[model samples]
Target: MYQSDITQFLNQLKQQKPTLEAEQRRGRSLLWDKQPVDLDERAKQQASRVEQTPYVYYQNF
Candidate 1:
């Protein structure tokens, strides 16, 4: 079988630290994992947003 340098390094790393994968999963969940979004809440927020004027710096007299 053929393995790239990165693959070999990863395999050796996993062997050295058996819990590395579990730790990675836990870290990923902390940052990347999220709960399901509430469509109703999102729609309400979108509907309540005010539209911005084309000329923000100029004051309308």
Candidate 2:
């Protein structure tokens, strides 16, 4: 949860806060710095999964 990081940030705020750009980069790094989703792969995953029953268990072997 970045508790320590938040504490450090608050402590720094008490003394000297960082610049707006620096804060923006830090916050963005925490949440928005992820790989983009691939539409094709997502579609493949959604379409590829199907449920099928191949065997009947009611009769004796």
Candidate 3:
């Protein structure tokens, strides 16, 4: 009985915790092992879209 209870708890946890269920790749799962986006490439892409000058870059912490 106790073992069954533990198994039920673990099953509940598996349903709740993201890192477990995220392995299936069904929906937009959280990026567990994701690479950092290239800031330079992103900036170049944005710069190509907009034709403006004197832009101020502010760092938000």
Candidate 4:
């Protein structure tokens, strides 16, 4: 069997810390994993948004 340096190091690291993978999953869930979006709520927000003028410096008299 052949193993790259990174693979071997990772295997050793996992063996040293058995709970490392679980900790990684927990951290990832905290930041990357998210709940499902509400499409209806999003649509309502979009509908309520005010349109911006093309030129902000000039004021309409």
TM-scores vs. true structure, each candidate: 0.65, 0.34, 0.32, 0.69
- Return the top candidate by TM-score: 4
Collision pairs in model 1:
none
lDDT winner: 1
Clashes per model (N, Cα, C within 3 A): 0, 0, 0, 0
- Candidate order by lDDT, decreasing, is 1, 4, 2, 3
RMSD values for the candidates in order, in angstroms, are: 2.4, 9.4, 9.3, 2.3
**Candidate 4 Cα RMSD (Å):** 2.3
Clash-forming residue pairs, model 3: none
Candidate 2 to truth, TM: 0.34
- What does candidate 3 score in Cα RMSD to the true structure? 9.3
For model 2, residues 1-61, the per-residue Cα lDDT tens digits are 4569889888778567547668889999999898889999999998998855566565455
Which residue runs does candidate 3 get wrong by more than 4 Å?
Answer: 1-33, 50-61
Worst lDDT run of 10 residues, candidate 3, spans 52-61
Alpha-carbon deviation at 56 in model 4, angstroms = 4.3
Question: How far does residue 8 in candidate 4 sit from its true spot (Å)?
Answer: 1.2
| lDDT, candidate 3, 1-61, per-residue tens | 3568889998898879858665567344454646789999999898889554555464332
The residue ranges of model 2 lying beyond 4 angstroms of the native Cα positions read 1-15, 19-24, 50-61
Tens-digit lDDT track of model 1 for 1-61: 9999999999999999999999999999999999999999999999999998888888574
